[model samples]
Target: MTRRPSPPQSTLPSDPILALRANELLARGRQLESQGKIADAARVSAELVNVAPDLAEAHQFMGSMAMRTGAADIAAMSFERALQLKPRSADLHIALAQALLALQRPADAARILDKGRTLHPNDAGIFRELGQAQLDLGQPDAALKSFSRATKLVPNDLYSRHMASALATTGAPNPGYVAELFDSYAGTFDAHLTGKLEYRVPQALAAALAEHGPVAGPTLDVGCGTGLVATTLPETLRPIDGIDISEKMIAKAQERGVYRHLRTGDAHAVLADEPDFAGPYGLIVAADVFIYIGDIGDLFASLAARLAPGGILAFSIEFNEAQGIAIRSSGRFSHSPAYIHGLAAANDLSILAEVSHPIRLEREIPIPGRLFLLRRG
Candidate 1:
């Protein structure tokens, strides 16, 4: 998540007249932001930056406004200028790191945060952000150390504590963690998954669906990221409803115009609330979603109750040889076939088909996966 900037701290110009104007503009910008006039606030900040180019606070405020407006590139540039004007400010370094992370440049963010940590070793904020950057770069061990240090520095910080625990234990991460992770990832999810990771589960699930006869009722796509399932499936499954945790991902999915409905929330809670979700779906597809869930027994139960008679529930899992589910350091879960079989039996759902494939490439190594089609009795 992008961190919002603190209130403006103006460095008045030397000239009394210019200083008076700068102070007025600065106050106006703060007032506009408080009143939710983000565009107006951005204009005010831009004007301030123009009038006092040497004022680091003006540039910082400009960057914060750009961040609020979703102009991450502009925010990064503005933050860089702020840092150049005030090299000693830890706040500037932190803001710049946030902009870089928003732009999906984790390496650069990590570098900046590393420097920030050097400059302010005791700052918990720097350690927390540095941990996130490390996690993004696939360095869980390093991230765990960073988060642990943050926890030590600020024991009351729940975010840091939760992150440290998630990395250290074999449990599902907090919903907020998943939401933030995907929100940051939503921009490049498609290309990173399909191109770099060789993700083909969506298309493979589509082909598997073809073997079944016509879908008997409305369909649902649980945890549908970017509408990949809707896009890959045959047009026969139009008007699919979707639920996901990330709003940014939901927005991208909405842009595809394939889904009839979409909402942002935990899939488990939505699936369990049948009256609200009104499922009884003909088909429910969850592509590459189980990796985030450590124990999916409750989810399976919910899905079973929502399926229409003879309805097909299709999903994918990172496969493992162990008897149950296991979460790795990479913050993804892998399930053994035995665990899935037990879920089907407990839910009274019959396994219709199972296909094993490479779900994606992690560090050039294939990650094994299993796609299953289960039918409600």
Candidate 2:
């Protein structure tokens, strides 16, 4: 199982009266930030900086506030100062690397990340940022290494999932562990996935459907979260159906009125039960849904069996070129292009079109999104 790094403990002095005052101010600032009063938090953080200019914690807090407020330059300066004081802090290095990336100085970010890894080689967050910096610098090979290290260090991190996907662009095999990790996250899936991740699988599927013309009979939106994709379906295709493993997510999807049917069940098993679902669906769409399934052989085979002849299957996946599909300690599977092609061919599905593009997540990270339009032969 992938382990997350524990939250950092407060190291600031709690005994000295002056230090206690600074801690109080910092605590208040954090509360304000959590309450969405970023401006007020900044003001408090500024006061902390004045009282403890050499305090690494103070600088780090101010840096986070600046970054949150779109003050990238200021954030960088604050983080730099913090690093100078606490050069061993891996979290500080990650923050500084992010600020540098915001300023499009990936090379510099990579340098800091290297130093961070040296200090905290076992920290997954350091490797994640390092991998991201390498990717931004167009060093796919290096990025792949960093991401691989990150998954080993912190297999459960979703950031590692994104990093693994990015590295896959270099034709590296997909990381095998991502699927089960995602399946675990499926409980809180919609709440954590939408709005930020620019999860356009739903949108991409909609676009594919639009390009192909109307979906003919009943339709199923597999792994439909919050009904974002289901709602996008044309009204003519009423009685749209959706299925997901997370009951909480299915509830949210139902609230959107996008699907005539919504059920909480395994995607593969759900379709298997509905053998007659074939021909009823003019289209079957899975957006950003297959990343959690390590082996698409079963999924593709099941989908082909469920589709009518000439019926389309549109879905989104985070592609990887990694070899031999295997599950990682992280629980998600990365797919190789060969693996994807093999699945399509084995299932008797013809790939009509496939497009690769950047997918944005909630934290402004751009993940690679692969869209495939398949027709069952």
Best by TM-score: 2
CA lDDT, every model vs. true structure: 0.84, 0.72
Clashing pairs for model 1 are none
Quote the positional error of residue 75 for candidate 1 in Å: 29
Per residue, candidate 1 scores C-alpha lDDT tens digits across 1-377 of 99977544436688888888888888899999999999999999999987887788888899999998878899999999888777778998899999888787889999989899999999999998898888878787899899899999998776676678767865556556678888999999999899877888999988887875566547889999898888887766665899999999999999998888788888888766646567778888888777886778787788788888999899999998864865553557789999999999998889999999888876456888999999988
Could you estimate the TM-score for every candidate?
A: 0.60, 0.69
Error at 313, model 2, angstroms: 0.9
Misplaced by over 4 Å in model 2 are: 1-24, 50-52, 70-73, 98-110, 117-204, 257-266, 273-280, 292-295, 318-345, 351-358, 361-370
Instruction: Summarize candidate 2's per-residue lDDT along 1-377 as a digit string, tens digits.
Output: 99976543434555487687888998999999999999999989999987766678898999999998878899999999898877788889999999998877889998998888888889988887887777667576777788788887776666576557644642222343333444466566655566445455666667777887655757778777667777677776666788876666777787787676777777777777754343357788887667665556666777777777777888876656566353222223445567777888888888887888555442354655578888876
